[model samples]
Target chain A: MKSREKEISKIEEVLIRFHRRHETFQAPPFWTERLMARVRGEKMRGNGFYRAGAVVWRFASVTCLAAVLLALYASGLNVETPYEIVELMFDDPAGLDLALLFASL
Target chain B: MAHSDKETQDFEIIARIMGGDVNAFELLVERYRPLIFGIVMKHVPYDRVEDVAQESFLEIFRSLGSYAAKSPFSHWLSKITVRCCYDFWRQHRNNPEQVLSSLTEDSQQWVDTMLAGRSRDAFEREASGREAREILNHAMARLSAEDRMVLTLVHLDGRSVREASDLLGWSQISVKVRAHRSRGKLRKVISGLLDGRQESI
Candidate 1:
């Protein structure tokens, strides 16, 4: 059994060496152009999806920013506290009453 | 090109591609096509080499946004290319039509000559024949895709366990264990062949 293992190991090394001696292949002529055309086609297909996604993201971001800026502008941007900003953004009547009470205090 | 300069250029090209100049990708493909082909050729069937390499490059381009640049670009590229070859084998692993090439008489002679303990130089000279490739491929076909990848990376490619693990995204222990088992499997396959040839005599 031990001798068998040794023989296998020897053969494995030889075989690996043999395998390594195989010449490295060069890319066939004009293969890069063929590959590039495929890449460009794939990117074109992908860009449609990406462009739609970008539009959605841009719209969401602009709407959010515009809403925030409009609120700050309408409230005079002088609402110093986060509580005031939240009050401007939401209709929590009880919280509004609490803020009024705090202001009076 | 200097190594650092090449890396800088690769990063510059990657940045340009990410910045919406997709045409900049041609530079990268041109630079690494040889490296990618060399790797893919070793891992995939000869006929599928171009297909697999093309797929690898597309994958690299798609995932360019995720590259963090901590590791060298070439190492990352190698990992992706190797993974593409692995995927190729995985996809084909279940095909019923996958046939092992028969070992030829010349391959049998090559094996006999190898086992007969000729000098190292003589062995090296004769081992480059097409028969040796056929015999190796015959045995390698029996291994699972994972085992085949590990054996090729470690045994045939002469990569260390650490390097193989990095390239394979496998734990070192897994790579080490798989390498040993795959080698044993290969040995058994070859041994069976040798025994069969002897019985036929």
Candidate 2:
């Protein structure tokens, strides 16, 4: 038992020494440059994806907005000014009355 | 005080990186490369250290946004490095035989000495540092990814169970259990190697 303990202690010591010995490595002078270059490349690739997604989203949003405008034009609901829309909303007495009731409540 | 100051500086660097100053990232990589490389070398094969270290840096960069700063940035980076090492082993689990067969002549000799049950003094006198590291690496390669990560962090790197638990995002009990199991597995691998050497003799 004593011998086994001694052997284990020796193994532990050797392993610890080994671990400490290998702890620090001299990184090459070009390491930072190489890593930065890779990071830049990755950023560019990521930007490509982001740009593509932005294009798609912008296209979808514009398409939706154009479609809504076309639908409103087809329905003859186009108003030239904000006042006209406000006048149209107030033209409904029931909505005005409901708004007044809610305001009071 | 120094710790918080470093943390604040890291946060500033992170902010700059997030604000589209991509060049600021070079500072982070420069600061942490040695640390990441050291952690990686504990598990990565010698030739593949650079590749794995680079992969860890890229991974850190990609995942930087998710860092919440609840823990120290270094601890979080250590976790990522450990995970990359685990992934390296997972990707190569089936190739252990190939790896073992590629051990250098010096490592093989060291293994033979270990198998002979040489005394500690004899090992100290005879085994070169490279041989000792290679022997440990060989034994480590045979372990499971979890075992390798836990053993490297807790045993080889001299981290406490709590620290390892924090880094691994595992419970303290889980870290303790894994550490125990990993140590057992490592001992078994070493013993098996010694036995194989004896039989070959």
Candidate 3:
């Protein structure tokens, strides 16, 4: 048992020394620059996707709004007062009649 | 006091990076490059150390937002570096022949002496520092990536099993079992190398 312990100790010492010897490494001066450039490239690529998505979303939103207005106009609804049309489209006509009756009174 | 100061500084830098200040990340890279490179060098071949180290940093940066700062930044960085090394070995695991053929002449001699069971004193006196490193590296290359990682962390780096478990995301018992098995495998490899060398002699 004692001999085994001694062997283990010797191995541990050797390993510790070996580990310490490798604690310092010399990286090139431009390593940080290269890494930064790569990171920036990654960021730009990510932003490209984000910007493309934003543009698509904006275009789709505008197109949808325009389509809705075109449909309302084509249906012979008033295009100048779009909210009134929207209210008439969505609200109960009885509610609108009641609101108009109140306004008249 | 010093530890907390470092933690605070790391937190500040991390916040800046997450806030989209790209330049702030350079400070982190400069501060930890040696540490990351040193750990990476232990697991990878010398020729590939730079590439592996860079990959590790890139991984760390990409995952920067997920860093909880619950542990020291160095510890968290080390976990990423170790995983990078593991990934490297996984990609190159089939190329054991390449690793064996890359050893220097001096390292080959040192391995012969170690296999012969020479006294530690003799090894210390006779082996060049570079040769010692090479022999260890060669021995490590013979083991699986998991074995190399567990042995280096638990035995060589003197990390506790709990620390290793946390770093590896393994149960403590699992780490202990793997560590024991890895040490035995390392010793067996050394003995086998010595036997092969003796036959060649």
Candidate 4:
């Protein structure tokens, strides 16, 4: 198998080199401009999509966060103030609001 | 400046492009035109090779900012080139004749000159040896895309079996085994063609 592999490689190399040397080279030079144009077009198109995605994600996030904050504001579950909520975990035995939040969701 | 020197200058241009300077991407394109074209020609038809090659370069530019820089630049470029050429093949799957057009005339001329005794005589020292290879390429075209890609990536491109495996995202064992199998298939086809050629002769 090794010898045969080598024989095949030798034959292929000769054929390729022969093909390469005799092949007349021609590729349209203007393709550089064409390609660059396409690149720029795609870049613009991608940026447009990115901007649109950014807007959607931000709106969704802000809306969700705002809904959470607004619900908390509306609930009026004041033991006293916003700082009182932070202390609730450590001190407040009351778990009623937690149950209410889950039930609402 | 010399082409290589100019090409080296492109790294700086690429750095800027990666830094969000879109204009610098053009320099990378101008610098690597022939290299990308050469890679494309290996798989694409002779006519559509240029645009497809250009598409690869654009993909490289658009995505370069996310590149990990762990791999060699050409390997990264070659990955995109392979993918773009595959896309070209997919679009042209219904018609193989439209593969790559930029080099159709030259390629036809190339085939004509090759099949004739004119170019064969140059390798007269090894003319008898050349017949098998021409047959091999013909046989190669008949293989499935998966087979053809594994064969080209390993054999024609001189990539390591491991590297070819990595490029194609197959296990190294699979690459080695598939490469071995494809060679047997190629040899069988070449032998068949040789028998037919000899009978005609």
Candidate 5:
């Protein structure tokens, strides 16, 4: 068993040496240039996405504000109270008083 | 530059990158190219070193937002580099051609010399040859990617489990378990080769 352990240790030593012998290689002369080009391309693509998102956000904000203003206009903002709003919404355009509409309430 | 100065500069460059100055990134690539290449070469095949190194740098750039300055930038860079190598192996794991190369006769002779009860000096000299490397690679190819990486880091490269865990982003216990298991697997591969040789004789 001892001899077997010794043999295994020797094998492990050789394996360690295999790793230690890793060769030192210089980066290719054009490696940095190529890498930088890829990075630039990635940044450009990211910027494109950011710009698209900004445009969409601006459009959505404007559309939302416009919708809210339209809704307020349609709802008769000139009316001052809940009763006035109800009268404004239900009164006939020909000038019916709408008193019957609220009498049950 | 001093280590602290380099760290400070790395932060400065990262700030510029975040602030929309893409050209500033080239400075970082130039500064760390050697370090990145060295790490990749140790863990990746020679032919794939450039591709893997490129992937690592791209990942570093993409992940810069998450780099919280909690540790030295080189340690973070190392973690990325090692992970990239691990990824390369993982991707290649299914390709039988990458894993199925039989041990050559020359490597078999080298293995024989290792077990021939030779002197330590003789063993060292023999282990430095190309055949020794071939044998090691062949044995490693048979193991899974995780096993191969853990064995390489802990057994062959002489890194502690803590160091391996940090580089691999694995829990310490996970690294320890994989390291022990992979070492046993490696031993089995070599012993199987020896037994086959003995049987033939």
Candidate 6:
């Protein structure tokens, strides 16, 4: 009798679930059409936007690498310049010249 | 004149949608609207439900191409819908409280009296059922969004704790604990509401 009662309860739950499902309307008619259009548009938007972004990123990376290379070459090539020589003198102000010390010796 | 079979998985429809078949996505929209609407309606005001529901669909569409088919499509779609609903909720300035839904014209009165009366017990239960549901609904509104969602999915929707966890993208342990706690909370709130209702009567 207890087992029978459990079965009855389970059936009641199933009936409740059935009522819930039956009572609600699904999507309205026109929304489905609208959603389809929107989905297509969204897909197009993703492809268009992301592709454009990818191109921009590629350009940016290349530009960044080129700028770094140019900076390195410019600094490396500056060793023989008069301004560089003066800048070196200023850079070593804490150290005295070896030639002046040798002449005194 | 053909409707897509409901039994087919989402990935199948999605593949067609990507290949530029617009109607495939329509099938998807039809299939999931109720599920999406259920989640969104809980978080948003009546004014926002339609638009937010649409936005949730859009979000799903926008990200559909990136869908990896790892989880079932419904689970993935549910996460997007929940996030969209939350965003709508967050955008509201007045500290938002969730409310149990009452019927409007658009609300489906799904319980047909004829069928509902088929079982004498159910018929007797029906009059009191709405009151019970109403109490639970308002009581549910006072809970946190996560708790509200966990409760709805498990109790109202009749999903397994595991399925609810999947729907919410929550871990099994967390889902179980939340479900247990939310029930206790609901029980307490419901009893209070019932007591108050009786006193008022």
For model 1, report the TM-score of its A chain: 0.51
Backbone clash pairs for candidate 4 read B45-B100, B46-B100, B46-B101, B47-B100, B47-B101, B47-B102, B48-B100, B48-B101
RMSD after Cα superposition, model 6: 11.0
Model 5 reproduces a share of the real contacts of 0.66
What is the per-residue lDDT of model 2 for residues B39-134, given as tens digits with 9 covering 90 to 100?
887778777888899899999998898999877899899899888888888888787454554456665567556546776777665544677776
| Candidate 2 vs. true structure, TM-score | 0.70
Q: If both were scored by DockQ, which would come out higher, candidate 2 or candidate 6?
A: 2
Residue by residue across B93-181, what tens digits does model 3's lDDT show? Answer: 78755556345656557655544577768756544367666657766877777888889889777889999888878799988998999
* Candidate structures ordered by TM-score, highest first: 1, 5, 2, 3, 4, 6
- Indicate which candidate wins on TM-score: 1
Better of 1 and 2 by lDDT: 1
Error of 5 at B150 (Å): 1.5
- CAPRI class assigned to model 6: incorrect
Instruction: Give the lowest summed-lDDT range of ten residues in model 2 chain B.
Output: B96-105
lDDT of 3 by residue, A1-105 (tens): 554444444444554576655355677778778988999987788668867998999899878975665464436644457676666546654556435544654
For model 5, the stretches where C-alpha displacement exceeds 4 angstroms are A50-105, B1-3, B117-121
Candidate 1, A1-105: lDDT as tens digits: 776667667767777887676567767788878878887888888889899999999899888976665564546647777787676658654556445534654
- Measured on C-alpha atoms, candidate 4 has an lDDT of 0.63
Clashing pairs in 1: none
Judged by lDDT against the true structure, how good is candidate 1?
0.84
lDDT of 6 by residue, A1-105 (tens): 554344333433433343244333345567666766676777777778878999999899888975565445446546577677556557658534423433554
lDDT of each: 0.84, 0.75, 0.74, 0.63, 0.82, 0.62
Candidate 1 chain A, run of 10 with poorest lDDT: A93-102
Runs in model 2 deviating more than 4 A are A1-9, A48-105, B1-3, B102-128, B193-201
Residues B35-129, candidate 4: write the lDDT tens digits: 78777877765566766876788788778867765665676787788877767656655665633222223323333333444544654544333
TM-score of chain A of each: 0.51, 0.43, 0.40, 0.43, 0.45, 0.46
Score residue B21 of candidate 5 by CA lDDT. 94
Clash pairs for candidate 6? A23-B110
Order the candidate numbers by lDDT, best to worst. Answer: 1, 5, 2, 3, 4, 6
